[model samples]
Target: MAFASYPSLRDKVVFVTGGASGIGATFVSEFHAQGSKVAFVDLSEDEGRALSGKLAGSWFRRCDVTDAFALQSAIRDAAEALGPITVLINNVANDTRHDAASVTPEQWRKALAVNLDPAMVASVAVYPMMKQAGGGSIVNVSSINAIWGPGHMPAYVAAKGAINSLSKGLGREWGPDRIRVNALSPGWVITPRQLELWLTPEAEAEWSKLVALKDRLMPEDIARMAMFLAADDSRMITGQNFIVDAGRL
Candidate 1:
């Protein structure tokens, strides 16, 4: 007799929002490796399609998470093409840092819609699907700034804080359904773009001072934790925010 396989996301269907780049892209790739049929959404048609082409078990759709109706439609289509979505990763957000006091009201609203509203809509959309699948996981990608109260990103901070609270509340509300909800908050992982455009010597010095790990954190580092959460290894974990900040408080 053949031994049973034990991949955490084996045969599960996962949908990731804003998975075109950064940490979101890593999530998509990691899940695909775990034997899950993964689908992701992004507004960048070229990048999204290219990623889909490269990944064996992945689907990509052009979607703007801020539009609830569009998101709903995209989710439905992804489900139809793939299978019932057992894992939902709400990771889409535009983090264009700006001076809070100078940001226009419209821009603030746009930021919140992209960062916070997508969490609500994505979670809500997957409720029935997860229920049908006999329970599932919803992992929201938040930021360390949620806890740090970072300056100049007032809107982003507010959105991430709301995501944390929403994660807890939803976990409580959906516990009976066997659906787990949680948040993954990452600290200063030096993405390629950040290094080229923003990471100064002063910033590197500060990072070294704060981080407990001598090695620098990268997108893959955060992706590893997400894989744990997506897998059954974290079956008992829910409503808690897992901070993968390289030991940075």
Candidate 2:
């Protein structure tokens, strides 16, 4: 499907976390297609390098977002490579399911670190850059699992819920600086990881029955909403959760 182009996004600086594959990859590609200067970081070095090469002028750095210091350093390096990041897409997350009964303290902490902490740390690291640029947009990728109260992966749900809350708080905190922050919640996007790990025939049929739209969501579906949030089209929108869930919620 052809999507509308945002003239405001032309030449804007964009940074995305976990942009080597899946939904995050779409964010990097879409922003680049819109003429934004894109720099992205991911743990998958090979995929990241390939994607960066595919999109000329885009920068790719290997970063594990769980490490707060490393994440901050990556943001700095991305800014240096692509100028101050005026559009930050906090899209890194690990949704590996674990039995609540078997979840240890360390496991819980790791889940939060991967799914939640980076969003906050990355936003903090880029605040000055965004402010100095006059204004900017931050889109925190969340999930419908947080709102649906799904069973299994309790830590993932908790972390995503925290992300939604953090987005709201940062939106208010930085609004005066002309910075906008919003949470983008997606439902059942069929990425390669999901197809490999979770998208069984039974699961797909059940989810299809629940969503208002018959078609399953894709990475580009979520990316389109993100692009709008990052562009001037959403200049007045902030502190809200934008769900691209086919009306499941």
Candidate 3:
């Protein structure tokens, strides 16, 4: 089904990471439209607070997902405010392109901390809660680089590969609890930052050539798939990675 016509998410509480802007913000808006009470964390205090206010039923907390204590506190407070979260979207990622030789040890750690640790921490935090609440869904946002590394971002590719594996491992471990875990890997989506930084006319033309679809994958396109995974419609799907790449691979 099309995203707008997807199943109702009334009474569901969804927690999203890095949700102040880009694809994460798109997920927040889409979930709100589905009637879910959304809670999200982001480093951008102003945008986070403003978006929270704009989305009346949603809550936004200023947090760096790399910080375990902050993430725990934010999740706990948001759960208290919105009730037991029925969905967790591990959408926080550090996609700053860096080559292997250029990446320092600290930079590599930061990349994994941002792209992979948040999923583990958030999913683990929600485990007992979801078990007590009956069941829920966890969607880890991976990247096309994980499947097809383009060479520019070694750390990003490594981190995303870890995310995909982590999702699968958690899915198998948590299947007994009825908590679904999966990954969503998107291709060259035209976010504002990407358009400004990466999408030169030549880059756009090359990216388009890789995809079968004439149109590029938008934030909404990825958000729609995320919503499906978050909802009960995909109850039986777990330990799987869905590529919303417009056939980039």
Candidate lDDT values, in order: 0.87, 0.94, 0.89
lDDT tens digits, residue span 22-139, model 3: 9999999989988899999999999899888889889998998899989988999999999998799999987887778888889888888887888899988888889898889999
As a TM-score, model 3 comes out at: 0.97
Better candidate number, 1 or 2, judged by lDDT:
2
lDDT-best of 2 and 3: 2
lDDT of 1 at 172: 95
Candidate numbers sorted by lDDT from highest down: 2, 3, 1
Candidate 1 regions off by >4 Å?
1-6
Determine which window of 10 residues in candidate 2 has minimal summed lDDT.
240-249
Candidate 3 weakest ten by summed lDDT: 1-10
Model 1 Cα shift for residue 150 (angstroms)? 1.2
How well does each candidate superpose onto the true structure, as a TM-score? 0.95, 0.98, 0.97
CA lDDT of 89 in candidate 2? Answer: 96
Model 2, 160-233: lDDT tens per residue?
A: 99999999999999999999999999999999999999899999999888989988899999999999999999
